[model samples]
Target chain A: MPKLDTAVVGLDIGGTSTRATVLTLTGQRLGSGRAGGGNPTSHGAERAAVELLTALREALSDFDPARVVAGTIGLAGAGRLLADPAGRAAFDQAWQDAGLRCPYAVHGDALVAYASGTAAPDGTVLIAGTGAITAQVRDLRLDRIADGHGWLLGDAGSGFWLGREAVRRLLADLDAGRTPGTLATAVLTELLGSAEIASRPRATVDATIQAVTRRAPVELARLAPLVVDAATHGEPVATALITEAAAHLAESVGRIRAAGAVTPVVLGGGLLTADTPLAAAVRVEIARQWPDAPLRTAGDGAAAAAWLAARDLPEVTDPAALHARLFPAP
Target chain B: MPKLDTAVVGLDIGGTSTRATVLTLTGQRLGSGRAGGGNPTSHGAERAAVELLTALREALSDFDPARVVAGTIGLAGAGRLLADPAGRAAFDQAWQDAGLRCPYAVHGDALVAYASGTAAPDGTVLIAGTGAITAQVRDLRLDRIADGHGWLLGDAGSGFWLGREAVRRLLADLDAGRTPGTLATAVLTELLGSAEIASRPRATVDATIQAVTRRAPVELARLAPLVVDAATHGEPVATALITEAAAHLAESVGRIRAAGAVTPVVLGGGLLTADTPLAAAVRVEIARQWPDAPLRTAGDGAAAAAWLAARDLPEVTDPAALHARLFPAP
Candidate 1:
């Protein structure tokens, strides 16, 4: 019989934050911890490892480290980190330093996301947060991907893409000497501040452009929420932009997804997971594209990672029952 | 009667290079000089002034500065520079330092580009070099503009756009596990050396992606010539990209152009001025869009600036004749 006090560790290393969860073998959440971004590609390997350890140690504080039976980490940019020996070593050292004695596996974020939604072994995972990418998972492993090409090259239908389109619409309106719609006005106000826009009506467009171009291009993702808000208020420009973004995301999945495959399709990232207009639009698009495939919204990735760790343990007799317990149907 | 020794000074301030010309009121190209970029928006105002002085001094070496009757400067980012007091002061200081005694007028680069191709005072000018922009000109002044939003926001059919598209095509092929065509292969070879591609067939895609993402985004413009080369060799991908670019350029002009206007349409910048496949495609698209409008390729902007300066002078009676003499119909 499995020890009643036995626990498993799961981590979700994202670009913005690292989340860790400690769960018992029977799917009871024991402790949870969060820290700053721990993705090696965004932060250096050393810093990422340090962050991972911080979150891990915090999560393990309530439960004794010795009682941890298994561990799994779902890391963004996993391929790049695995390819670098120094990065791999840093992560390995981090895992060991966290007092993790049991066997642990590191999987791509896509696979973890797929597992977070369902226990399916084969499926497609589409993510559209700061960047956009779709991956096909086979046997709980990432098989192929499309359009995660970063901001400069691709990332179409992503937050950054949506924000960029909003700015573009404002520019088009300025070029045509037309008054901007609610979305464009909101974007301008957000970027240039209301005072500047009001004080220099003629210079608002130029000021907005300079303000946007002066920052890191990825920061455009911050404007995405404004678009959603505007779309919710029945703003035509925002509505059209959301529809176009949905089409781009659907096309990205279409490029990698095998036609007529009816496996589960998991949607990840804040844009899709949240109950936003963009999420609704994407669901409609996905359903239209794959009417037969069941769509699932990902739950807490760290919890899913812990579940993945618990599923294969010999002590856990019914993995599906535990998954249901961890992530009850909404 | 106009003094035979009277000359006009013209300056073309570009982002990469600045050119200055000295021309007799009779349209004689007396002397010309070139220096580094003098665009105040790219380089700081102080540095831009220095570059302008350098080119002005060189051009004035063969002519007496006091005998220069009028001067015209066509500057990129003219709006931004004019809006800055420091920039205006710097350019004024540079003019004084260069020993130019004649009163000078500053104009936008779009006006100079339109003047370069023809003597017409009203029409449109489309430029596609490092960036893409289209402007309508009325009475030799920039009237309305479209799509000069730089690399991040717009510049849809620009060199940067072309290079980014090339990289995207290569990435797509890599994602699909398919062999890249000539254009994508050439882009990979250029970004990651030929040896790397030959040695690590499996790693080429990742390596190429890393190599690209590590650099400044604007550097992607450097790869545009390869697209032109590939298209010239009958590569389908390159051909398609070129066609798309042409459509975008045409669309930009169409946005600002009046319907059924028989005004002259001028094409400027390296991409359109050179007798390349992209240029030919643009010409075809332009012809198809506005068959009644005369299509003219731009000549040396410095000379066009000199012609503009000389045209309104008391000494020059035949401005059209001087324009023809300076541009020399091809």
Candidate 2:
């Protein structure tokens, strides 16, 4: 098949920042842009969105609209299409008609990871980042999600969860009047900057405490490896947290398999990219839990979402030629 | 000290039924009565109070008014005492004089379990009835709690959780076109009284479907044993439920122990009574989770609550002494 020139733009929205990229029908990144701020949906549905579109426009300033025929956005915490009409309108309008150029598809970031990573489109993605979400892509639709229930309630096997768990263990060590173990002391010092977390007043301590909940998904995800480091150094508490996180990821993978998904998973995001023991732990757990499942690394999820959007628009290019255009010889 | 002749009453108000017992200073069952109706608090607060008082007065008609000093009533759910002085007055006037009794406390029935089961004045109680709630009694107060987030949300280690889980597993099995496993088939048979739960009409199924959330604590609680039995009989799903339930229970227990509590634990309610393997599994998990903690059994929580109430007010002769006074000997 001849290479397609027309391209689609994909936007990856994270808690702290946003990244945008234009990919050709062959999956090559033509131009990219980045911006900052949490998702507007997390803030007020309306106001946060205005800021996002403004930011998106600024990111796409260099791109020619004629070359960009369609778009897709992989957003954090957006499980599926807005179930409620009002929410859908709000999401659509907030993007300032980013979907106006062509049919815009919005999905949870997990799908982007799967599409980009898995050699075949039918597989799963374990996204253990600043916030954790497991996305299983079966065929072309999003299917069988697990965890990602937010910070106060769930999000069991995530980077934020790991950080919080480390803090909890550290506090316990201090209260028990024992030497803070390697993991506890390291993570606690990282979170509290001292051994005085136990002595500080609740409000004061809480203020000093790191915002483990809202770390920038791509940046704060680096903490997962620190935990892995401590665990590798024989830190029992750190090992347990990482192991447990792996188990949770594995459980979600198992559910996807049980739901009739076959092997081949794409691993993506901050936690998976870290060169640490925890990532190995996750692989071991996944292998043990689903032995037949193969794993692969994923690229920028936004590009995949853009590729998907472009795939549906035959006027833009042949759908099958999207990935090759985006990542050719990259 | 001489045995006192004064008496008090204890009421256990549930969703579908209400039980009131009169105990002589020695914790002897002087008189007992029952009523059918839901908790008044669930109805209009005022209307429920009026009806509740009417029932209380009817029950107390058998007791001499002058002898009743202080009493305690255990209710369902958590909330602060209605803060409005006038509202409290109206509530007291509405429930009749029972609300005016000195130290008359309104608490969740899980407290009844905690008081009834634990040998210590303060300990933890795992209530696995229709709904599940794990309560920690510390400093004579209903201190920390976990689960009981209702059936739709949490309640991980309860019988209701187990039953609902079994149903989900069965449906998943059927959707996969696999013959239902032993555990799934048993649950389907029990829930639908048929070979397939999937075959039932949506509304008919919804109507017949035992929503574990609205279930009587006692009834939903009874499901744990079925799962345990299935596990012992070699059912994978049932065994998994018991194991998962134990893990959840241990997590709750761990949080309590981690929060600087050294109190012993009391396993209470119908779920923990002798003969069920669920109790043993829970105990093993608790032991593994909190190695040094002592665990005990609670027999007849309502009766135990009455006994503890008496123990607190020595002026009311001790329940053991009162039992001797009333019955002459064991």
Candidate 3:
């Protein structure tokens, strides 16, 4: 087994899922894998760490572990760094890259999104995925990002927000004398699998109200894709939700712009970069907000950033030489 | 004790607090008390009923059960009815409320707010107290109300929304190169005591997370007063949130109007009718949306409804007599 020298691992931890990648000296991916469940920050960092380690082991089943040198993780949560001097320091390692025994770097997953999404170490990046966020980078200082507060409080332009809004509109339909069997209701039935959980159930008579309540949001968020699909079919509520999300994303960009960022914005995340009406709505809104600004895909941005980060290794002396090997610059 | 023929008892149950009021048919208050902890809806109706009955007995301290001829309850998480119907229907005469053997009438606490705040029954009412809701009463159907989907998914234009939005904005400010010691931060500190709950010696991470998470909307709701206060002091964020809430409320009214309901509107609840900028904002927005629509307070409306409900009660011999007794014709 070749002794790994100067390899850096990057891990991205999101609320719905976690992903880890092992990058070789030349920025080539040695291994990668994904795991299910929620953010470990809410679930305890140690438990999350073990889950992540298990995931990494599974991802790198074919790779020799002795070849890896350093690891860093980007996670979503209250992103106050645990190692920082002022932090209460509840979370030391990223939930996706947990149980690190070596010198490891950890930052908010938004930072990783920013780093990998923008393809530049210093630039403004907006992540609009299952959740949405905007971050600014200048002189290695991250500043002025918007809308990454998570599902409970804030997360404007997120899939979760968009999905939930669709549910609200559906309820409004019931109130507005519209038929109950609209797109939203159908979406809900498919998600919750019972009318008892969807509509205003007689909660007082039910002993299983908690069981009903627990499934509510999941029922609601599941309606998001239906909303997107409905918008494609010209449903007003679906269109409104997507449009509202786009407007929010635009407002976030405006906030980043207000914070004195000059770099071209990188838009990354599942909801935004997907080939859907939401992505189209976002692009249109962004164009209206800033006509000339470039909006890049998160995948390209992440892969580019990963390739770029790998160039920092002493083994990869020339960036262009390595970039060609990993990805051909368009 | 003499066997009493007619009397009134009131039960108020909140998510974290409970109160009971005893009264006579003449509306004379008899005894009132409060209890700690959340609603039984979260716990399971049977368990909650036991707790409520136990608490009521502890608070009542009375020997006579025959004096209670009728009982009315106001509870949170009860949906449209305040009684634990599932428990009662399941256990028959096992519950203490059944032991009293009184005819019972149950309604949402929102109805209590309406009774306490409105002047008529036939109107639309907006209540923004600990939780916020806008209810429209068109004839006999109490249809088309908004807000109160719990603290997580929805509750726009409510105090909870305001508080949560404020926190998110403060966090955004931190990410934007600003510190976290804003007036919002001060309010949070005053509310939660400190930001280092995760580091507390006896803290469990999920519990702490849930505490903070659950408190976000409540905290946002707390921002309602702060926004009103800040408007008095002339702060931008405070003013904006209130104004935004007003707009959202106006949009709601517009939707109501679009649904072809030309009814009188009522504004009640702690947040809306409070001595704050919200009253002015709401009035302005509503007037802008529905220029000629009648708007009034909900206290009379609730009293009128309660009066009406009382008149139709099987115990009432003459409807006119009850109406004239509860409400004199102007």
- Please give, as one word, the docking class of candidate 3: acceptable
Best model number under lDDT: 1
Question: What are the per-residue Cα lDDT tens digits for candidate 1 across B28-114?
Answer: 787898999888877888998898899999999988888898999998888788889998999899998988887888888888989
DockQ, every prediction: 0.54, 0.06, 0.26
True contacts kept of each: 0.62, 0.00, 0.38
DockQ of 2: 0.06
Q: Interface Cα RMSD for candidate 1?
A: 2.1
Top TM-score: which candidate number?
1
lDDT of 2 by residue, A156-243 (tens): 5777667656655554444234567777666655655664444423322243233433454233345556687888887788888888
The TM-score of predicted model 2 comes to: 0.63
Give model 2's share of reference contacts: 0.00
What does candidate 1's lDDT look like per residue over A33-60, in tens digits? Answer: 8999988887988999999999999998
Candidates by TM-score, descending order: 1, 3, 2
Candidate number with the higher lDDT (2 or 3):
2
Model 3 lDDT, full chain set: 0.58
Model with the higher DockQ, candidate 1 or 3: 1
C-alpha lDDT values of all predictions: 0.87, 0.61, 0.58
Cα-based lDDT at residue A193, candidate 1: 73
The lDDT-based order of candidates, best leading, equals 1, 2, 3
DockQ ranking from best to worst?
1, 3, 2
